[model samples]
Target: MKNIIKTILLSVAVLGMSSCSEDKILDLKPVNNILSPDAFTTPTLIESYMNGVYNAAAIGQYNSTGANGGRGYVWGAAYVEQGECRGEDVVNMATFYDLTYSSTFDATSANNVYYWVDGYRLINRCNLMIEGTTDAVAKGIITKAAGDDYIGQCKFLRAITHLELLTYFARPYNDTPGATHAGIPYRVVGVNTQAEIDSETVKPRNTVADCYTKILADLNDAETLITTGNSTAFASRVVGRASKWAAIAFKTRLYLQKRDWANVIVEGNKLTGAFALTADPYAPFQNTTGRNTSNSESIFSIQHAATSNPGVNAALASMLKDRALVCISPIIWRDADWKTDDKRREEGKFIYTAAGIKYTNKYTDVTNRTDAAPVIRYAEVVLNMAEAQARLSNSAPALTLLNSVRNRSLANPFPTAGNPVGQAYTAASFATDADLVKAILKERRIEFLQEGRRWTDIHRLQKDPIASVATNGVPAKVASAATPPTAAFVLGNSFAITTPVAAIPYDDFRFLWPIPQIEMNTNPGLGQNPGWN
Candidate 1:
């Protein structure tokens, strides 16, 4: 196991490359000790390593992140399924209590170690690609333009992967905008040698500010080199690889997390002319025929193939549709103002089980988990702009942007074309900016449920969760009503249930997970997050 880890971590650059049917050049070990110099000298070899980086992306499943010898790195969809369970919008209905929601979960037992390892492991591969490309260009092994392209791809992945780590492990950037709060160590160089790995082992966390600075630098460099033309040039090769637009869309997320409202609007505006909302909002997820991006609402998404499934449990369908273990929160689902007409809440969406509990039918593919996982979407960018404008006190514009999303979903009626009436609101509907902002937030809750972003939205906003894990229940039909009935998870003795309200304080240490004990034990320099010790 140790030898395998060493090989995966240290020698990722020199892994053998061969073209596959999927256009991915895989790491086939034809020879025992290939030299990095020989492997990374050509465009084909460098691209092979880049494909490996893409291959390392997790599909939001327990065992999918390649930690503890897990299988296959496909796309960012893995993050959504795994992340949705952490937020308040969804409930894990099975006996399994995900560590993300467990108050008593300890540092030693902290889950998602795969998240940390998979991220850095992939970043290390990117570092190798970046370093190898630079050296290849300097030695005239590859063209300067080729080197730049490779570097841009590496940087884009590096930035987003680092940001993912920060989202899960480190304190939120807004917790302390300055370099005071500890963020994950900003690792740029590949751990090529044993000494370099040892040095990295002892390095402390960088400040949140430092990490963000590094992220922005990488994004800026990537955007400068990876223009739309460059992406168009490579269109015939791969459709979903990160491009200039992906970088811009990611900045909207990054800026929102940091509370940089102005920049959020600035970055979001760049996307307005490029992509339009899906004619049918569900078409992006409903595309079962193939992995084509035509008529996609996503600015960037991880394309999954039917032949290469990310397991039932790891797939989004398992949470709600196929396995049907997790369900929408009864309380939130029954909310009076959750946009009844919105296409997201069609009748079959929440199927009734024999237990009188309703499970989501959002994930339709039980046979093959080949659905495209969204990383960034056109609607999210609109919301980002709306939120930024609201924060900047541009109320009229914010409401207009917010209403645009409301209107889009209204226009994209599903299951018999406008069976349920859609709701729309204007600036006159809200008395103040806060009201409008809260309305937008609520819209997101309804819009993005089970997409794995609710938890991040709650934490980044520093809002207290409305309920906790102990407060569990499922929504049931109440006499052919439009919405489902809400029940509570009862305690002992009386055999009675009460609607429970468990609050996770905004400052709760559980908001930031402890660094897994395995990581701490293996590396002497690694430190645990506060309140975990």
Candidate 2:
């Protein structure tokens, strides 16, 4: 925490100069005196500071300064690769993500160490924004409404970062009766001075339940404070910035992870009329035309541009499309449940086939690498509600919500007299609630194929009582060096591989990532996860 804290304080002094070329929210000018009293006095200076925080959280320090600097929450970094490659749906074909793919990472692994460092760095920046905005309001530098909006954005970033850390560094919420397992430190105070850094160094990790409580508290605050009418500055920046609907949509994700079915529905209901799925599956990902902002499906996204994106090395297009470091694994690709005529499997759309190898084209900017990193989407919200309703035995509404996303990709979504049984799911389609839930989960895998969401579902459902969809641990996958079929891939064909990596059971020590070695050395109070030492 000391090293991470020091970085945060140092970054605050140069916040204005760290602006990246991004959407209007991130187009900031340099502020000569950022640390002076006049820093938060005007909208321009305040927005410049906010832009720095968003840049740090979105793009990170990817300038080759250090190993972890290349990875951030978005831009095909730790959150994207680690979240997908660690699961079974995607195959790792290169050395970049091998440790994460094979579950062989240790405390000192670059991915493990820097993910923790960058996450905490972003958290502290949010803290600084929160504290700075409160002071601004007190000193009459900004209005109460404006201050609340800034603080709301800070809280939203803080809550999401903490949750991301918990997903990797700690056990699932259901691992214990009350989620009493060790959780990551939820920092709310900004550390600027030497005294603050020293004080933050000795703080201990919170329990998983307590961490979730704090996350929800911050989100609840954000829900109330982040509104379109509060300030003119915020109303115009709704596309890229957090809004009331984004906060509600995020709550659905958190509640789904916790298995809070009723709460999931409650938060999901608020987004009913606010957003809808796009008619085409690829509409949300048309990066060249800025569809990520214009599309109705996107709730909140981290916008990227030609100049400000994680370059070829770490961009989503580079990793998943152009370089093909990670390919769509045959495991999900060969599943018969995914209809043969599904539009998502169509070449040149979401997927592309070349040299008999299949790659995801979800991020299409192979050269420019300017694809927007989707944080939350309306489809996810619909699926969240669908799963929650299925869990509570409300089958009709569940199927309706499920088809809202799944139907768009199917060749024939609705039933007709000529084709009585169309592709859309019916009430009779599932034998039981467990069956319905399983179908919804499968839809999530296909809908969010290469968007780095598979591992999150795998993580939260590891301890599910339902045996069908509950994952034991990391499932077996095609070997890293497994060869693709020599012939062109055919729909529903058995593309067998001779070598398959075995599964790691739930009880394995490697199930959870170890605390970074540097954090352990710097902060004596912090303890590592089991089997790391």
Candidate 3:
């Protein structure tokens, strides 16, 4: 990891070469030290440099030369595939994510290796931005407010990158008491000179609890310093960039993962009037028409453009919709809970049929592949608060919050009408708090089907004390080659699988991905996750 960060720092000269003309600040001549004092001069240059950091971290387009070589790195298709295929909600129908689907990935697998390499690469860029912006403020090149905003954005990116790495590399927070398991190294400083690189190479991993503490600290600082409105002197106020609400929304996710119910609600309440879910469930995924650009539901997303995309192989539309590499698994698609008449299930809208298999149409730009990757959404914050309320036995507010997200997509009425029509729950619907929590979990599975959120639920719920909300491990999945039923699909139809893949037990070491072999080779002091050679 340290060696990879050193390489990324050294290669900063070619950082934003593929970005637009406004973002071409880093296309300067190669130099021995690109982070010299003169690098942070004008507002345009500083903003462009920060744009390069965002391009590397959120867009994953700048540095694609290391462990994953030609394949696009994380924050794009690789990010979506890794998160979705690890669980049973999505089936891997091609070779791209087969190893991930079957939990057979080793330390040398490209997916895990590149995820670590690119994640730290992004983190190092954020560190450099932090240092550069602070220096610019001290030298009076930029105001204190401007410098703080830049630092806040860097911290937000840094926090998110570390959280993503923890989801894959470390065990669940509840797997052990106090979350004392090994966590990834929280890189807070930039690696520019040879001495800094040497010092970073030997840093040991931190505990999961420690990692979460650092993540929350960064997010809190970001919430305080980041701008609040949608407009600013620079382009940092756009939807894709971090803001006060985005930091708060992300804190809900982190607190939810840690099972801190009160904190989740506290953070969620801060976003009550700031953002709201779109009336249409499919509104947030419309990229070609620019509806997603001003989507009220999207809190923060990874921006992609026609000229600057993850390419055909790694684009979300290409893999999930056009090429049909992975499709919506029957495990969730055929469940009786997901209504047949729901807007999300309507053909050509969110779900599309190709060769009798259902693929997600959430991403529509197969040619341009410019679909924006969603990081956090208003729906997720609502659901997080809903689950937190249910856990606390506050059933009334929980059901109301759940319906706010669920009612929009429910267009048709069920055959038997009552308070709970079309799968909308009421106050008397759940007999127990566990049942309400289970319903909230199911809603999460349905609402966030292909948005790279399935694995997050599975990871956090694996060791849950409540039996209904807990998952044993990766659930049973349909065979990759198994064909859907020839008859017309119905809400309750059972799509029998001729070859059922067994589930990985919670105790299996494969439950968590191995530390990349490259990291082990470069930093021998770093320990590997058990059960991987």
Say which candidate scores most in TM-score: 2
Clashing pairs in 3: none
Worst 10 residues of 3 by lDDT: 10-19
- All candidates' lDDT scores? 0.61, 0.75, 0.75
Who is ahead in lDDT, 1 or 2? 2
RMSD of each: 7.6, 5.5, 5.5
Tens-digit per-residue lDDT, 360-419, candidate 2: 888888877677778888999999999999999999999999998999999987878987
Is candidate 2 or 3 superior in TM-score? 2
Instruction: Indicate the residue-level lDDT of 260 in model 1.
Output: 91
Off by over 4 Å in 2: 1-5, 9-38, 62-69, 74-77, 228-237, 288-291, 467-471, 481-483, 486-488, 497-499
After the best TM-score superposition of candidate 1, give how far the Cα of residue 455 lies from its true spot, in angstroms. Answer: 1.6
Candidate 1, 360: how far from true, in Å? 4.3
lDDT of 2: 0.75
lDDT of 1: 0.61
lDDT of 1 at 42: 69
Expressed as tens digits, the lDDT of each residue in 1-533 for candidate 3 is 12122233212211212112323222221122334344578776788777767666544533343221223456755777788988888888877788888888898777777677668777877887899889889989999999999999889989988898899999888878999989889998776554565667667899999999999999999999987454422223466788878889899999999999999999999887667788888888875435345677888877776766667777788788888888888778877778777898978888888767788888888887777888788999999999999999998899889999998888743335553454566777788999888888988989998889988788889878774436578777777544545342445554464427788887888889888765676565678888886
